[model samples]
Target: MATEAPQRSQLSLRPLERDGFTARVLRSLTAFIQTADLKPGDRLPTERTLAAQLGVSRSTIREALQTWQAMGVVQIRKGSGTYLARDVRATSLHVPVTINLERQAVLDSLELRRAIETDAARLAARRGRSEDVERMRVALEEMEAAYAEHGFAIRQDRAFHEAMFTASRNPLYLQIFQQVINRISDAFNESRENPFVTEPYADESQPDHRRLYEAVACRDEAGAVAAVTRIIDFVESTLRHDE
Candidate 1:
């Protein structure tokens, strides 16, 4: 006799309102991405499977998946299982704990940073004023001081980057970067305020800042580009990652 296949078991998200099912699904999905280390092109379980895992109606899962699709977060195929889209703005920056985002988005952000910052660093090397270098040095000092006292220098870190952008002497770059900062401001605020996320990095980053300044101050365009690339590369290599 042929044996019957066992049914897949259903999971639960207790204390959830039936009406709030869709919202919960979205949050749960992103949290899974952040925690599970999911990445672009990674296949997600089927809608039926997600419905079971989330303890929600299959229709609810379908709706949430549709929303994710619209948001460019996921790609769906008729027979092939759903997948994370190749490109995403992780950190839920657009959505909302938005929390620490997944690795893909962090990598994406870093790539963007490298392009923009390297140009800025190079331009600053050519056109930067002595005052600009002074400001960077000051920001570096403040970063060191804050890192020494509080063990994390979020404000000083941002200030240094802001100063770098300003030194680029390009209003367009500054304008574009301001928007990027604004988009991440919420996540940045939460991360810095918590202190837990910022920890384990004090006394580091000093040399990178100094090197960047020296490159710019000495009018070393290629060197400035390398210095800035190194800085962003460190960030890309470190900090946030799970999948």
Candidate 2:
């Protein structure tokens, strides 16, 4: 008898909460695209399937999908299915990314991240609110907790940086930085075992985070600058060989 072909696994989906329905749905769809290697004219799963998979109502899925379709991330097909529209580079939502092993790419992304985040820290220190400071603290706590429990803590780390950027209160800064950070995260994860999963690297990162936390908490602009610089330097030296 001929052997059957291996079954392809469905793409994993992140859980969706009611509070941030739109953002959650959009993010999920984007993740699906990334995982499935979706291109223009690719038909996505039906609304019923999406609703069930996302744990949201069909109406909510329709609403979010429609919003993306309008934004040009997706094209709704009358009878076939929803298709991810053409080249998404310009129109699709950008997320923050991490360094890749490719020397040139890693250096380029690192420079962009450093430029964006260093300035964000400066702005946050200069004009952040008590609430913003509190958010940073919470994010830090989440990171520490995740680190102790999970082998890695990218999500919380991402959250902390994002909160810091938000504290800057510069919409443009936050938006662009988020885009780079999210995409870089994939590269970062692919190389995590090489750079981050080991001994000294993991141990050393905490002190850097501590310094950044202190700087932001005190709203010390110079200190924030110095702290962020140190953190970025660590990332470049340890994770990136090209820079």
Candidate 3:
């Protein structure tokens, strides 16, 4: 006697009609996985199907899937399909942060960074290796050089923060920081001119990055936290001033 193939579980996703559609799709997918009791290695519905179910564009589905892939929530194989990369029941996945050029959103993102990065800086000061400190130094130098030549060091500045996150010896911190940075970059790219990329902002912010690196290098945990706080506070104030 032949046995029947195992049936795949169905997902019930409602159409989203709100701003930040990509973020909402991600949240909806995460909720579905939990409510449906999806296990690791379980394949997800195709992008086409998900888009239809969510009443969103294929591109939106792809973007949300890509974000999940980055977070290690799902694994996408070309020609095959997307699958849950881990057991959602065991792991807690926060909804990835999304940003826009909106004033309040930008301020909220800065606050989020302040909360995460300050603690990360303190951890890095306590536990960072020599190599980790070296990475921060190199990134800082590159940022300074880039700013001198181009009047903007957005890429280099991001590199500096990434180095800091790595130094914290926490993979989750790096992952969260990358998601926030990616959203911020998208917001800036959509705008005609990125305020954060301006000379005035970069000039004001560069010293704080150096201070953060120095504090981490010296294993000054309190100083590290203070430096990170100052950097975020400056950005928040700058944004408020513009409004």
lDDT of each: 0.68, 0.73, 0.85
Model 1 residue 34 distance off true place after TM-score fit, in angstroms:
42
lDDT of 1 at 55: 77
C-alpha TM-score for every candidate: 0.53, 0.58, 0.77
lDDT at 84 for candidate 1? 88
Best-first order by lDDT: 3, 2, 1
Clashing pairs in 3: none
Question: Could you give candidate 1's per-residue lDDT for residues 80-163 as a string of tens digits?
Answer: 978988443344332321222344554565566677788999999999998988898899889878877887777788788878
lDDT of 2 by residue, 1-243 (tens): 996643325565666877667667777777677667677887888898889888899998897776666445678888888987855443445322323446567667778979988998999998899999999899988887877776457678778888888889986677666656644554656562546554465566766776777788898888988888887888779755524
| lDDT score at residue 225, model 1, on the 0-100 scale | 88
Q: TM-score of model 1 relative to the true fold?
A: 0.53
Instruction: Point out where model 2 deviates above 4 Å.
Output: 1-101, 190-194, 241-243
Score residue 126 of candidate 3 by CA lDDT: 96
Between the candidate structures 1 and 3, which one is better when assessed by lDDT?
Answer: 3
Residue 210 of model 3: what lDDT?
A: 93
lDDT of 3 by residue, 58-148 (tens): 9999988988887788899999999999866425554676666476886777777788899999999999999999999999999999999
Model 2 deviation from the true structure expressed as Cα RMSD, one decimal place = 14.5
Q: What's the ranking of the predictions by TM-score, best on top?
A: 3, 2, 1
